[model samples]
Target: MACENMKRVQKEAINNWRDHLKRKLTGQSVGTKDWLSSIKQQQDFSRDDSIPPLTAPDGSVVTSHRGKAQVLAAHFSSKMTVPDPEREPPTVPVLTKASLGNITITTEEVLQQLQQAPAAGIASWGKRWQVTLAPDKIQAILISRRQDAVNWDQHAILLEGRKIHLQESVNILGVEFDSGLTYTSHVRKVAKDAAWKLSCIRLVAHLLDAQGFGTLYKSQVRYLMEYSPSHGPPAPVIPPPP
Candidate 1:
């Protein structure tokens, strides 16, 4: 008799679940709102009197609920340590300008990358995962930490008897890099560019509310710097002039 009762209960449960799903699909039910509310209210779940077996701190397994709770409480309490007023401050490394190695390797495998010609205009992409490199558009930049500046306009690198002129800086994917690798030139250019964009946005600032203006700024002016490969100091938000 008990086995038959169990089977009946399971069948009723399955039917009710099917009905609930059908109602939800047909838009007759309250949808996920009802489910979400149940979660927030902590309802519909059956009570669980059992807890997982826990190991005690003293190397023995704790089985009792009260003992488990006490062990957990002790474990949690140990995590919070009072800070000593006289404790010496921890040491941290000083921040300095990053250095890059100057490698002059032109292996046979990557010889095409080293090839450059007297270039004109550039810079593309697709999921087809293809790239076309024009030798004339390839620009070369030499990164160095030397204090003295080189007259790059007069220097050129040779590849397969073709003269490849050296540039003081190279612009790759919207980020500019100079020979020094200090990003000083990149910062200067970003500031100048951002200033012009800020001025353009300022003209229509009066027309937009705070939220609207912010959205516009993020989409256009702010993201211009945000999406860059490396970021410089943030450009100040110039207030709209009265």
Candidate 2:
């Protein structure tokens, strides 16, 4: 009977040690994940491709992979080309002090003038390559302090003879800018998106150890919040589960 009691005590001691080790490892894993997530939020600048494909100049939607690539290539090529020194530079209208004082300038008029100013340069470039600008893909945002200052309904910008309506917000690169220049909307959007992504990550948490989970969080959730071109509100902090 004494032998059996001694064996039982030994088994209990082993089980306790195993449990203690498991708990310690789990704590370490959690700490590592937290650290990785933090590092990712600071450094990651990756963003998902959510923007719609550009429409070609022919008025047909560029849906195919090759067509989309070609459109992007053409657009970027035109922007990157150097102006020829021998070629006469395109004339741009200069806004003089006298013109500004004499004219009863509304926001719409300013927008129109600015829109028209770029036409000469674009036309000169298009003449060389025989490539026309895609009006549908061009977007405009009117930045103003007053909410009613921009006449969105009345104001329309023309590019290559096609009229394009103004947008309340525009995403240039990965950053989003609204008409008011406030980043509240952008911050809210990033937070909501990160929350959704975290929920998805939770499903696969078992598949990944702490290190793996941390890496995933950095690449996906943290990246969305960190990459911004303009100064805005801080990203919403979401603490990891204890």
Candidate 3:
């Protein structure tokens, strides 16, 4: 669950940074972006504030706060750092549009080195699942988006083994709904939360892009990056049959 933890920590840092910026913009002096650099260091989030914050006219208190925010943004821009692009590129070739519709291709091997032995912990309710390996060790696990069809629309990855299960049971006549019943997978026990799966998938796709296994067109990445956790933190994991 390292990725999940990372996301949690990253989200907290981002919110704190945003709060810092808000405080600065609202006529408060927030230390430089690096002053609270501890947040950035804790998570692998990109801290590039390239576009300066819009400022109010000079001398106005609100404007002054906005101006300070701009200053912080500028400082953030100056501190921008990314892996040297010129350094040796990843060895894996990127998947093209022709490969996009294919559901068979996965970049699991890229994270094969990351997979470690299972951990010794037991499931919360005496369930059959055991948390395996190092924290965040599971880079990917296949989940069926659809059981009958192998379309890309029905397949998803449990990047950190988080699943969403509907809490309240609904009765439809004589049939009982058992969470995500409509979204059945060949492999059952998938996370029912759409946002969580999307988050994991988005991050997995990002990691793949970073490794040259796949590409994310800019607009798509922008949209996905803007996805917020409206429901809640990712759901806990449920084990599948061994």
Q: Write the per-residue lDDT of candidate 1 for residues 1-242, one digit (tens) a residue.
A: 99999999999987876665444444422224443443433433323424555798679987667888998899888678666868888997868778667876434423334343223222223213455655776678756554365354455456434566767888887677787776788888777777888998999999999977875675556645654454443333333322
Candidate 3's C-alpha runs over 4 A off are 1-63, 79-85, 89-143, 150-242
Per-candidate RMSD vs. true structure? 16.9, 21.0, 23.6
Please give the lDDT score for candidate 3.
0.40
Model 1: per-residue Cα lDDT at residue 168: 82
The numbered model that scores best in lDDT is: 2
Q: Candidate 2 on 1-242: residue-level lDDT in tens?
A: 99999999999987876665445444422344444443344344122322345699888887556787899898899899877858987898876755433647576567667677675567678879998677665667767666775466465566666676778887776577788887777777778887999999999999998877876786677656554343333233233443
TM-scores of the models, in the order given: 0.38, 0.46, 0.17
Off by over 4 Å in 2: 1-115, 128-131, 228-242
Question: After superposing candidate 1, which stretches have Cα over 4 Å from the reference?
Answer: 1-136, 145-156, 230-242
lDDT of 3 at 165: 27
Q: Report clashes for each candidate as comma-separated counts.
A: 0, 0, 11
